[model samples]
Target: MDLDHEPATRAHEARLWRDDGWTAKVIKNGDDDGWAVEMTQEGEDEPALVGPWTMGRDKKNPKPLDSAAFITLVKTASEVLRRHEQQRHALLHKNVTIDSGSDRLRIDLDIIPDEYEPYAELSAHNGFGEELARVRVQPGFKLSRESAADWVANNFARPS
Candidate 1:
């Protein structure tokens, strides 16, 4: 994300921080120079925090949004998110279900990071205690949760 360009055209402002399972970002209004902070928790569908922000030095109004500040904010926010994601991803185990009527399968993925080894375990099994397949995922892989959900809905699931 390039903060050099005005975020006016963007739908959402840059994220600022992610801590305690919550990610915060600063959103700006295109119509006016209004600013708001948005905090979204991991696995949440919506933001947990949304409120007005203080304007720059010109106490009367918010400081005009600019590239330098925007870039700094984005960099800091991204780091927060990255650290939070890494920590959470390391300790939490995710369970994903893919069912096809008569055949119901549950996929369990455990992410672990250690001094010598760091990887995610992907395993699939039927409702009955039967294993189907297992694979290992590298830590560096880019997994877009939103994109994955969209792909499953559009390609695998029936259209509503």
Candidate 2:
């Protein structure tokens, strides 16, 4: 593992289930905590997610980055992505709508907690509020962002 390089901008490829995408402009390394990965969609300016990663087995305050840690990070990061997708799918209904003129799509997802009967509704509009989809997820279902991402990537990533 090498910590010599300063925390610069980097990118990493991520694949989860039916979704395959790349995370660009990831911070190389962090100072106080372990390495941090900044993730965002290609066209989206705001970051979709950002998570703190573990350092190598150096037993130091901040472990360096290495091949092994990188692999682990990928696996961990993939799981995060999967969970997000699952949560989105579970929370929302399967209704999708597309607009004609603007070429926009909108998706409505509802997440219900077991404790409460009412579910939280989240509406995500792409391009415009034209393409709309909705899904109803189990309120009791637990959401593990990391595990879900890993499962999808390992089991459902597109070949090659």
Best by lDDT: 1
lDDT of 2: 0.44
Best by TM-score: 1
Put down candidate 1 lDDT per residue, 1-160, tens digits, no spaces.
Answer: 3446432323323335444444556667555677776555556667644556657676544554345554454455557668977878655576666664577666666677766988866556778959766666664434344422442445322212
Residue pairs in candidate 1 whose N, alpha carbon or C atoms collide under 3 angstroms: 16-77, 55-62, 56-63
**lDDT tens string, model 2, 1-160?**
2357443344433322112343433353546644555555434456565666444477443344444445555466567778988977755543343343455444343455446476544333557454233333444333343322332334322212
Clashes of each: 3, 26
lDDT of each: 0.56, 0.44
lDDT of 2 at 92: 51
Question: How far in Å is the alpha carbon of 150 misplaced in model 2?
Answer: 41
Question: TM-score for every candidate vs. truth?
Answer: 0.32, 0.30
Model 2 Cα shift for residue 40 (angstroms): 6.2
